[model samples]
Target: MNSRGFSRRDLLKAASSGFGYLAFAGLSSMAAGAGSKASPLAPKAPHFPARARRVIFLCMNGAPSHVDTFDYKPELSTADGKTSNRPGRIPGAKLMGSPWKFRQHGQSGLWASELFPEVAAHADELCVIRSMHTDLPAHPEAYLMLHTGNSQFIRPSLGAWTLYGLGTESDDLPGFISIKPTGRNGGAQNYGSAFLPAACQATRIGSEGQPIADSQIGNIRNTKLDAAAQRLQLDLVQSMNHDLLKRERVNPGVEGVIESYELAFRMQGKLPGVMELAGESPATKHLYGLDDPTTADFGRQCLLARRFVEAGVRFVELTHGDWDQHRGLKAGHSRNARAVDRPIAGLLTDLRTRGLLDDTLVIWGGEFGRTPHGQNADGRDHNNKGFSLWLAGGGVKPGITHGQTDDLGYEAVEDPMHIHDLHATVIHLLGLDHERLTYRYAGRDMRLTDVKGVVHKAILA
Candidate 1:
């Protein structure tokens, strides 16, 4: 204080009497020392009792045809060659029935098209939402709306919001992870944390067999320094930062950095054990289709997701790409479905066998659904008006279909569930009150479901 002629008074007053100082001391120890247990992602009890403790978000990059996949419209077949009076950009558009037939599968008598035989087998475990709608028709905007509740610009992704609301369940792994193929739309924006702390951001891993990164410490081999030596070096650095913090108030960026380093140090120790895939049996690998050339990569990703969530990661996201079927609907969708179907069924099976299904939520769908009317000769355009998504495990009422579209499958005719409503339901399942869980940003308190959202309680078990 003498060198700069400044006392602690120059800084912003601590929020609590001495709690701020105690927090600072803890932060300091974390920055310079190793083995710090203070990860923001560390699991903690929710604000209330939660029905689900984890979530697996299977995002189909391009929208899929709900009529062809899950929503069996018998009338669509009869009206296949006829024009429709449905309200849309393409008025009086010709109806397009699915090329495949539908059959009731499982004891639930759920109508599923031939495209998803594997998923159809698990019909009793699914709560199919046929009334999901969104605000945008374009890919990026729809994606933003689905993930962040806003189509305007950057905001905290759903994963980040979940992390902020619930923290982490495992100190070793990130609370949220994004599993992606090589080239995909929306890029990192789909998983980025715009304003929340960086720790809330998704830790992405490639579907092409790459580690998240070389997580080893930068200078792990350079210095022969022992643990005691490392502690001293960290202490010196912390002292310098504390002095600087005394001079400058409201140092969120600095504080965030300190917290990040501590979390990284903790991760470095426990990550290796988590990455070992050899521990899995050969039968389990084959169940996920890991040996099939077409499904191998995506299957591996799904397997890893199961592994991560089993280890207590709060959320895990997996994406399989190129569903933008502007043409060649048959080939495009078949390939996409082939890549994911068996692996997804296997994931549910494995989770159930491990007794994790009841506590883990599994969600599968795209940003939106494809139009029932053909955009080109063979393909459908974006239809945000209504689509289908499925949820399994957690507290979802299994073996049930929740909503329906009109006879032509053009509009949501019953029990409309908006994207915001879906978000609200997810938060509710996790024991979070969507309206009350808010963060102050840009002079307003922002939430996942900004000003609108209604949890669909009827779908809950």
Candidate 2:
């Protein structure tokens, strides 16, 4: 209960008036009193000490195959071309051996396939989770589950929740950012703050050319009237809104407008530095594979992600789309892998070299993994039963593989981690109580993990 003896739900009722409520009611309340640091995303002393301060989520939109990439099963090699009559979607699917070869690397003897030789160099930095499972096999549903905790309902994204719970390290930028996300799979709803304030929603910065064009302050014709002009305009607006607030103190839309305008004005000057890769040398760009045609686009995105986090953005999401390889498996997977391989490795290497890896959590995986068996005699279908995901930096054990799958790589035989568990562990790394970092919505307090989540302590360093 709050000081008002009201539950969080009651507070939401009191505060959730559209823009008017947010601007006048909420901001006014916050502004009326000085010395109040009440942003939902403000960093707080964790329940326990935290090992990570920021997160970079590399979201592979299409599922990548665990059997082909990270999890190597010797039995698949021997049982190549054999048919399996399992109770799966395809009645009699032919056994498929990985087209690539896996070799043990580093001191940990972690096996990485030829597809990601760049990432393989950092094998010792990865904690591979082989037994990861989810509820759905389809992209829309599974992607939603992976991102928003719930498959059906709109809710605060984990990034938004993180910001709300922890607050911003730099008030200039949005705490959550999503790069080149897919529009179809859950769309903007994936990153929407839902019940959380609009401030916590991801600031969508598109591919080069347009960098926050809408939010920047308009150009002033008179340079001489700069500060005085802005102050005069601001004061005029505030006076009008203040009078309006007296009549309707609970309008969220009105309140939201005022808050949005204020933040946007403040962000105008700070945004350019945040977006620019200011001092990045040509050598650094080339190392990230930006010089190569095949890898350039993804490379730019990865490099930008690093730049954003360096500027103190709390959460950064890097997304590349259309990994759904139902046919032409070799061509599809190879193209997808080549596009991101070097850039990803460069990000890891750059972070480690800059000493950011110690406090920055890096996650790599898709909505799910591909089925070992072919869907149409060529490509694999989506498989949510079992898959592989990996984490590096931010207190994760390096050069380790946790859990295993069946001989055919169909089922998780050990240490299965649900998506909820992954969410919980992520929150744990950032010093949040997964269960307690919640927003009141629809009469219940909604959390990222909901009622299901256990921290994967075994993988923690």
Candidate 3:
């Protein structure tokens, strides 16, 4: 202040407008660091020996059909056009067979349909879970269930919980990031901290359907003050924030603000560079299918995910919606698969070559699986009974298919993994005990599993 010939109040009064956005991010980040000396985002040791150091969820929004994709139901194909003998809903629905042909891929000989030929090339790396179920078939509730483990009540998301447990590896980036998030179904709650400390919340880059190149963190840039000037202004504001914290004793809002300010300051320079894909080699671009228009958007997202993880961001979720495929199952599913197939395969290969795959858990699936029975001309209704999701790397047994659906692929007949089990297993892979990772809230101890979760030990390596 003396050197600049400005008092604390002078700088704040001059820069108050520019600093308002920082507080907003701070509130949203819900970061820890309030009421404590150490950063809530500071990296910490895992509870026990760890299998995975980080997580990347490739969320295929709008339920994808199990029978057409990973769950090869030959029986359904043979019985195509037969009435759905299975049960209560959809009285006269008929069974549908995949138009796409399924074939064995890799040495594992796991079956993958023609729609995802590129992903099938890496079949040996996948641990396909054929028997998966959730509580509901509706998008909103099921989406919430997948991300937060509970749809009825508010809760911290898996990403938020992970950040709370392990903290972030990067001080320059958010601990958890959701790129191209659709922000629908559950919207912010999908990555929200709920009752957890605000520090654990995610930093969103762009929303779903938005082009990655056009996406930017709003208000991160300040035209009024240069770097040096911003620093002075930030210090003054932070001092006020800390003072408020001292007075209040426990202020999560203030803590989040402080942390967010610091992070916003640090990341302003770094994040821009990360978003620029021009630095990547042409070969790298091709590998991610960035050269093609059909794949460019999702490819860009996948590339960003790789970049963010390499920079030490803890959790990154990649969203690819439009998987619902209710009616035009053939056209819709084909296009969706074509867009992401090569990029995903390339990501797995890139991670392996870089040695990230060994300790980085890669998850791929939608909210739930679609019904085996056909809906209209080519559509499939939502089915919460049986589905499939595949896990790769992060200490999962390679080249194996876990569990199974019934002959018609309508119900999970063996080793059925509920949403809670998936959450528990995911946490387990990251070296946190699902039961032990609890946050006390609302007069009871709360957890991601919400009192019902059994880790799928059979899938573990």
Candidate 4:
């Protein structure tokens, strides 16, 4: 102030009068049917041609057993009930064969258990990675690794990176959405944007025990003001923000605030219709298993994911779990699979029929997988040494199995793909090079893969 020969008070007086006219102009523009100023979510071209326009992550929260589900190990069944002396073994752990039988399905001849009969029907569309390995055995660290790439440090999630690299295609909705996300094991941090702009963070739809339809952005509706009144108010706020931004020079947080306000204003007229399931046809509802009580909750979540992707949301994640079956493994896994199988199948089939699958990447897996050896008499413990996850569409080779586990399905025997590699591959599919897609933070460039990722090109179509 002293250098410029202008006091703070003087600046305030000038801003107050100048902003009044600016606010009025903004309001007039709104009245004239002009949209909000250039949105932060305005679609941007990817680094290169993108294979997938969107991604839908089916997060099976608890570690599902690979040996019992997709990785068929004949030796494990042949030597069932045998004692194991492998490293990291829980003292007297015994090798246990799957209670369910695996059968070859589809023209691709992919092996799947009876537990996932519905998903198996779509086996030809899947690119199952059998040798998935991660560093941690516990849920918290493993889940964090799966989402953020680094298990120990807090960092921007994969979704945040995707949003940061390529701005949202949807202005009315969030670029990244996590529906019915888990409340435990890192909680919101799983989708939090750590160093990236706050607006890049995921917009959570539902949480544990809450009906998905009940999910709404906080303070989305105003009781005191109608649409026109709200527009007037918002215009004034945006003018003040713009003035502050000019004075501040550069502030990510302030910029985030402006973007958030703009998005919320636009969402008022659009979000309600997008979230309403009543508008969906009876056939669509039945297809997603919304007619049945058991599958209704997950069915609704899956259907919403589809809707969000169709609405141009860049990334959508649907979480279902408590698949960590340490006791009553058979009963628990069966119940868990049954609840999601039909809905998952419905999602895939619907996407294919709607022609969304061609450009939408669909992923299915848990944080880690269960040990081949028994935990209790009948249950298995966590095993980060080997696991399985599957992908469909989005330029992946369909109906092919990539990599392999050992005879007992306890470790990745060949072409092991780590969590970092998975993240790299995902970004690659979205037309991003993980090595180059980085942000400057804390004096150095930070990336989702964190300097340790290699895209599995063999799986690419």
- Give the TM-scores of the predictions, in the order they appear: 0.86, 0.86, 0.95, 0.91
After superposition, candidate 3 runs with Cα above 4 Å error: 1-10, 13-18, 24-35
Clashing pairs in 4: none
Tens-digit lDDT string for candidate 4 (36-107): 244445566888898988899999999899998999988999878998888767677789999999999999
- Can you rank all candidates by lDDT, best first? 3, 4, 2, 1
Better of 1 and 3 by TM-score: 3
Candidate 3 lDDT by residue in tens digits, 82-169: 8886657578888888888999999999998998999999999999999999999999999999999999988899999999999888
Each model's lDDT: 0.76, 0.76, 0.86, 0.83
**Candidates ranked by TM-score, best first?**
3, 4, 2, 1
Q: Residues 1-461, candidate 1: write the lDDT tens digits.
A: 42333333422232112212112111111322232225444455777889998899998887888998999999989888778765444777777888889999999999999988998999999999998899878998888788888888788888888888898777556678777632444566677777776667777665423433322223222134444333333444444555565567446555555555444445545555675677989999999988887777678778888998988788889887778897899889999889889999999999999999998999999988888777688888888888999999989999999889887677788999999999999999998999988888899998989999999999999
Better of 1 and 3 by lDDT: 3
TM-score of 1: 0.86
Q: RMSD for each model, in Å, please?
A: 7.2, 7.4, 2.3, 6.0
List the lowest-lDDT window of 10 residues for candidate 3: 24-33
Candidate 2, residues 228-256: lDDT per residue as tens digits?
Answer: 34434444454455556556855545444
Candidate 1 regions with alpha-carbon error over 4 angstroms: 1-42, 89-92, 181-185, 207-249
The residue pairs in collision within model 1 are 32-234, 41-168, 42-168, 43-168
